[model samples]
Target: MTARQHDTVGELLARSHRLGADPRNTNYAGGNTSAKGLAADPVTGQDTELLWVKGSGGDLGTLTGEGLAALRLDRLRALKGVYPGVGREDEMVAAFDHCLHGKGGAAPSIDTAMHGLLDAPHVDHLHPDSGIALACAADGEKLTRDCFGDSVVWVPWRRPGFQLGLDIAAVKEDNPGAVGCVLGGHGITAWGDSSDECERNSLHIIGTAARFLAERGRPEPFGPVLEGFGPLPRQERRERAAALAPLIRGLASADRPQIGHFDDSGAVLDFLSREEHQRLAALGTSCPDHFLRTKVSPLVLDLPAAAPLEEAEARLRELHEEYREGYRAYYERHAGPDSPPMRGADPAVVLVPGVGMFSFGKDKQTARVAGEFYLNAINVMHGAEAVSSYSPIPESEKFRIEYWELEEAKLRRMPPPRPLATRVALVTGAASGIGRAIAHRLSAEGACVVVADRNTQSAEEVAAELGGPDKAVAAAVDVTSEEEIAAAFRAAALAFGGVDLVVNNAGISLSRPLLETSADDWDTQHRIMARGSFLASREGARVMKAQGLGGDIVYIASKNGVFAGPDNIAYGAAKADQAHQVRLLAAELGELGIRVNGVNPDGVVRGSGIFAGGWGAQRAAVYGVPEEKLGEFYAQRTLLKREVLPEHVANAVFALTGGDLSHTTGLHIPVDAGVPAAFLR
Candidate 1:
């Protein structure tokens, strides 16, 4: 193929995105793609050969032009002369920057050498499960031969570096007809003369390998599913997962806090219940991408599926400590004088016998992705065992990659985490009004939010708007029902390990005189507001105690709770109950490191479910003002003459719990624009 047939950067990006969009093609952020083409040199106005490849840490499926690093082909290839051999390949990564054409694009990936040194005009290095399965098999080379004949070759394991690139290039030169090679104990590397052809070669390798495993592989690669280890009924499974999540998360976050993700997918359950699960799990994953996210291995909870909860908890603590010690030893065995310090000594992924997997990271996305990558590892293991004994790269090799200077550099380049990076918040009645605003604010500050509301649809919509289930999840809760309140808190535990922040914002109001208010009206008001707050608090406190993590519970009480408002009997009493509960719980939970506070907003009529649902009009009539002027009437009554919106109340919630107010508990913040009567004296 001629240089004229080379793909443009745009086409390269399109190809990459397509490949990345499918998990079958490559794991997330696991592959690199490159296209060599000619571009007019900025200095000389002369056509110059250039290499454009995926940048460091960029996912291929979401590859944008900005995510591609561009370098002068001549300069890049010239590094071959200065190549300080395999022992000093780490220096080669820094050298890639010297070959940059203009500002380049994204930071050049460590795999840059593999693409630049390769002879092909287009190259793709991917971590597809099927291809990785073939790569990880003990008889990988032999299987490669049977799977694709000579159309694809086999390359022995070598840590990813300049030498590995040279080895692959050498293989390509020898096997002139080969379109790709199964990278032994790694993944696959495919190449073509054109972008379209490169993609085809990649898909061909993946498809062919998958088919080979499916057709030629033996049945029951994982052995029989152990009877006592099979997944429990759906409800039981979830209950177990929720019950176990807090303990796992707390243990994993010993060194540094981590958000959690739970996966009960069929694939995970099937793998966990198999007889060979322990043996294979101990072997760890083969792909560097897999271990990078999931860690070198997972900490498995070894117990019968029907183990008692107390026993499970005790075993989990023991397992976590053992895992930590093992991790430290692994680091010690591999650390060099210049090696980066061990990041942490905690398991990123944890597996339970009856429950699902729990994965932890700095944020929800990272946690979720870690679980997904582990699933990929499961697939690879199953395939490898079917054809041949599963074999992973040696621990030393993984250590080199995990603590590589280049990888450390990439880590350094990452932006600092958000304020609430590892925190999870459960906001009651979060579907709309002040609750929704609070949800948005906490999420903006980096907390994973559980949008708890009776309105499931609206709650889900709010969760989606906050960035889907990773950043936020919807949990239906009437708050009044102890069962539903428990379920909502359980959802928070299941969705994000456990709750760090709970906003008791669910409430209802009724404006009626003491003479007119019936016992039923009073009961309803107290039931939905005061009683609901109590139920949510009780449930939230239980999870927080289980996690052993200090938490915040902020009650959205009203000015009416403190101020004696005219013609307000039932609603005022409920608010007063909620307000006092804050003080009472603050004192009770202080020893547990739980801080309780309340926000007193006079009337957030603009964006309030309570006010919008006719309370605004009722209050307007009580004040003898037009419904449309109710906000103005309330504002005029305030010293500041300001109309408080839901956002104002939301801001106060953050102020109390957003770190600065760490020591300020049992405090009531008035977001009422400044109503003197409502001021807490």
Candidate 2:
């Protein structure tokens, strides 16, 4: 087939990326795209029509040719005739598998049948917020007609499967001139002989619906000011989210803990501030596609102004139990005798009166996705409410889609989870520099982090930036003080059951010659670098041993510890003591399965507080170079001629804590760009 007859695979990919890249068009992997093309039949040696649909679990925004599953169009379409007699959802999935063009590939999307039924060569299906608003409106059918007239078709809500595909096909057949179709309480679909035509039609319908809503006027904008309070800073709002995360996570899981992600963006704040928020949010998802991700309704909690944290905690616990009961009741009301077992009754999304919204998941990435989807749902719901009463697919239809085996199978097909998925990590000095990088990396790898620092403000800022309280929390700890160290450990235990890994990185650098180094300076260095390491390690060990979970402890020593440097006597001596502490601690803690290690790094000057606090100028003066070139000067001194970065130190710490070093302990890994003097003997 020539380009005129069919779109190139690259064109199809481009179309999918265009639609998926915009949050206005899709959320999480909620949308799908397909293009009809010719594939040579291996046995028959003839060109046959094949439908390349977005594979299940593929995100359209980052879609590629590999993400599209190739299916024999003739075989896929023929399944409709045999589908009416099929009763089970699993059987339908197996039937689609049999129609695959290649020996192995991702399973086609559940909507493959719908795409196959369309006679057009190109089809795009999306759950855009604007389109969903119209589909979920009380007078959705009338709104569709008003928006697009005869150019688009309207199909009522039907559970997605062979029957739904047939209904959609019938609608298109009756209205051959229609370029698009709106599924009540679901999403919109557009089709044309060319990708350009399909995309243009899809965007036009979305724009029309958005304009219609705007013409009706929107609800009053919800201001940041609460009833009895002045507007709070974004930091304060993030603090509220951080304070609430542990409570919600504790309630979500009784066995394995879950992570929480916070979103207080203008859209989320505006939606939650509305007087009708609870009523509308409880009405269920704006579209059926979101049921699998966010559940039917979000759990709403009314946080009283200036209420004590203890009171808020108690209220959340009570409301969470009530939400569970409501979910169970909703399930029983809709379940038939043959319905599948319940998928736990925990709420995925929660609404707080003053704190915006929170989403829970087993990992940070999933939680963030859930947050994004809920935020998009807010737009769709608000758009519907702005025009007419927000209506969603009936509970019966939502239940079927939520419990469908095909949908659950998509989740089962996901790759196994990464290591440290449910573990908790605490990083001292995380307000900036190496500790901050380590905290970010640990959270990325699925660990809940506690960002502990004496600088409470900076610590909280880091916690807020790392997806808010669910993924991390801030704790104030003067590591030199045993009381503060113990309190920080207690906070970690309370926040995440108990810490599994502790990074002892809180210390100071004192660079002065032997004669210039005062007694006070020497004492200050040892107090923080030596005493601080001991207290943190001891507390971490006590907690991990009591919990019977083997943990890891890593100290951030320095290259100067192993190889003395002129005018760096106090810091080097203190770090050397810290290194010895690791060996001693490992020997004692090894019996409890706890491992102790250290990373010796040098020249991490970028975000390092040490360099920012006069040490950089002193070092530059000592080398007779400008302060700005100190980093470069140190880099040139290293054998590899590379600057040591905080990320490099963080990676070294991660390697020691990970499985590769399970049998290794009591070692100091150098991260000084291959400094031979600092190498371990």
Query: What local distance difference test score does each model get?
Result: 0.91, 0.80
Error of 2 at 468 (Å): 15
Q: Candidate 2: deviation at residue 566, Å?
A: 15
lDDT of 1 by residue, 1-681 (tens): 224523488789889989999999998888999999988778997888999999988998888888989999999999999999989988998899999998998999888988998999999999999999999999999999999999999999988888998889899999999999999888999999989999999999999999999999999999998989999999999998998888889898999989999999998999989999999999997899889888899999889789999999999999989999999999999999999999999999999976889999999889989999999999999999999999999999999888988778888988998777799999999999999999999999999999999999999999999999889999999988999988887888888999999999998888888999999999999999999999989988888888888889999999999999988999999999999999999999999999999999888888789988988888999999998899999999999899999889889988887888888889988888888888788
Clashes of each: 1, 0
Clashing pairs in 2: none
Question: lDDT of model 2 at residue 271?
Answer: 69
lDDT of 1 at 497: 96
**Per-residue lDDT for 224-325 in model 2, tens only?**
334633224676665565556555655665435555566678877766666666677888886766767789888877764356778877888898789889
Error of 1 at 678 (Å): 2.0
> Model 1, which residues run further than 4 Å from truth?
1-7
